[model samples]
Target: MHTPYFSDRPAAARSAAYRTLWRWHFYAALFVMPFLTVLAVTGTLYCFQPQIDPLLYPGRLLVAPATTPRLSEDDLLARAEAAVPPGSRPAAAAVGSDPERSAEFVFRYPDGRQHSVYLNPYTGEMLGTLSVEQRFMQRVRMIHRKLLLGKPGELLMELAACWTLVMVGTGIALWWPRGALTWRGTLWPRLDWRGRAFWKSVHAVMGIWLAAGAVAFILTGLPWSGSWGEQFKSLATRANLGSPPGVWGGSTRQSTIPGRQLARPANHAQHGDAVAGGRGMDGMPPMVMDDLPLPSTPWAVGATTVPGSGPAGGSAAALPLDRILDIVRANGIPRGYDVAFPSTPSGVYTVSYFPPDPKREHVLHIDQYSGEVLEEIGYDDYGAVSRLVSYGTSLHMGRYFGLANQLVCALISLGLAGMAITGFVMWWKRRPQKALGAPARLPTPVTMRRWKIGLAALGMVFPLMGGTMLLVWALDSLALKRRAMR
Candidate 1:
């Protein structure tokens, strides 16, 4: 049943707007179809990210049985560093999350060499080393995020996201019930005839589910990409990651750390011991304010050293990695707490913050007990909207399970693929009804008989798309008007 509003209107008037939006939806579909297919196929292949993350780092997620005294963080770091040699400083030091687990580390070595080393953190024992970069999950993520083209690839993906967002809105409008929501009509199709309604049911049901996820992911992903990068950045600033209007661009304090900053996290790469004194755990002095660094740059470098956040001072006091590790242990985080070691004394111990996902993994800063986050330029102060936005991002990217999350996202990519297919087929079937062939369609008329002019008006709101639509409308409309005038 169609909505009563449209039904009440005379056929001529009703069809004008109904058909106009429909045609615009059709055109939008045509523009996005091919890319949707690419996304589908690539996304389907990406579902196995979980299976691949471990192949890159072995004996870590699950440790092999060993019967030696557990190594101290210092010793394990020392061994990992020595293993790397001086020219190639280790970037991160990761131990197993479990106390009884394996001592493994993803060492982002200099020259861009990354190796997942299996060690006896106690004995500095070298069990094995694998490449984190070459993992299947990594490859899958590459395609999903950018389809392998890096910068250009990301741009294309963002444009696709914007188009996808538009499609979702248009699709919802198109699917709106003619009247009151119905059981058989709104949800499942009537079981009477098992024909077009069955597939329509499938598409509609799926579309409804897709609407929420699609909108969420598209909006969240928009900020991370280049097309809407500036706009997205603005959103982040509003969300408190940046300064107020008229304020200068965010400085070190105003910025959020871009990636993980584990101080002694088990999964960290080797030579990541900014907190582990020069000596191994046995002889190292208790870490003090001077011993640990302050907050610093959030980006991860092949060997790039992040600048410090300066000296620490305030209401919170008592700086100690051992205490943080103890608390993690006390909280059942276990003997080997995966802590984000302070890059700066101001920097607190951050736990499990892999990028693209700010939540999912637990993050705690061993503040001067200033009792606030030390890693983020702006920490713990996120408002409710900000927190919700952060959670949405994690769920969208499937980062809750690390590699497994990657795989789930890869699978979601397939759903997008299906949407693209169904969406395209629907579009291909409708292109012949009406074509906007002239420039007059760029800016809609105040009183328009057909919805096409309204669509033309909407197109003008987006600078680039509006310009393109105006050009197409002019050319196509001119030819039509000429033919009609003739």
Candidate 2:
């Protein structure tokens, strides 16, 4: 008979430990396979969003390059406003550096729906309009993030992510090379092997190859999870290693105006009338930097208070869009920055510049009346943890190194999906009729001291996973005890 893989260990101990590990791996795979496939497919699609969007909506997203000067920002805004329905007001404007790209202005409707109006920069011709939520990439992102189920979906994804880490860990342990490793059935699958054996080799090999990339993808995405991400952000901020202190420019001013109130129908007599002259309705606090509908919001300053414009009665007119553009340019906010228009008298003009490189990201809050830059936070100002997260976020989205980065991410995503499929196939072939066909439980309890310690450490790091693991362990132990008594 062929010797078992763990030849160095005594036969009895090896048999028991291997069986236990196999059972654990089986349970993890059973839960993770479907979710892994879904995440992989959605992730691959989102990785190519930059190239995909233009192809999907070329008429709206692309334009002919022009050597002549483009229309002024205010003119473009005016044209975009005219293109939309009467009640729709411009919320934000995104200017691209590329001459071939059309200018995009986002408008919020009375019912809180947002639409993107595309305008040809050179001639101010209205290209087309699209619902922001219904856009192809945005839909893909929502599915990937929360399965379109809102908070409940978010919790499920987070739990899936936590379980995915467990699956990866158990997978690596099971795939670890044993005594006398060789390329066959290890680095490369044995093509000559038949049926279940052949598929097992392929699954194991692919799992190992994709392990590191999968782990990175999972860890990076955890920061965006609703539960764990929120707790992590709070902890990091408390440690002063996340958003940094006083980044709000020493301005304690806050507006009582809420975004929903501002989003009400423009049919109201005055702009302030809808929001009750910026006093806020129903005790709703003023919208913060996070409330604006910018295409990209930095992780560091998302929660920072939005400063109010100073000297309310000094001048009835808020600073014009053109003047704000001048201020942005003077402050060296590069091309491709987004300008979010003020919604109330106390609201500031929010400018966000998010480039492919995380190091160049910047956010500026400008007073609508005085044209003063109330608060400015750039990548350099981010604390150590915040900076690290910035880089991770960019890399997670495959924006760090351009095409090469996206290609690498795509390959990893596809590899993960392939592994999930092959794992399912292997399990299906071996599964007995009318049963789950999980690996059989070992007859006796086995000492897995090192494994337990490692698991404990992992649980501490991820509290949600830790809690679930404890519950599973308790249930498993009870089942084992019952089996022994029988």
- Top candidate by lDDT: 2
- In order of appearance, the predictions have TM-scores of 0.63, 0.89
Stretches of candidate 1 off by over 4 Å are: 33-52, 55-61, 65-69, 82-86, 99-102, 108-110, 120-127, 179-183, 189-201, 227-230, 235-252, 255-379, 399-414, 424-486
For residues 143-232, write the lDDT of model 2, one tens digit per residue.
898899999888878878888777887777777767565545587887889999999989988888888898898888897788788677
Q: Which candidate leads the pack in TM-score?
A: 2
lDDT digits (tens) for residues 1-486 of candidate 1: 666546777666556545545555665666665676675565555544335445655555445556766767666766766776466534344534454445655454555556656676555667666665565665666776787898888866766666665567666776777756564575664456454545555666667666776676666555455545544444555555532221112322222223323243222212324533333253222222222222111111101222233344565444444455555554433332244454434344544333434432233344534434433322234444445556655655565557766656665666667766665454344335475321122232223333444455645543445565667557656765787688
Clashes of each: 38, 0
Error (Å) of candidate 1 at residue 151 is: 2.2
Candidate 2 yields a Cα-based lDDT of 0.78
lDDT of 1 at 116: 58
Report clash pairs, candidate 2.
none
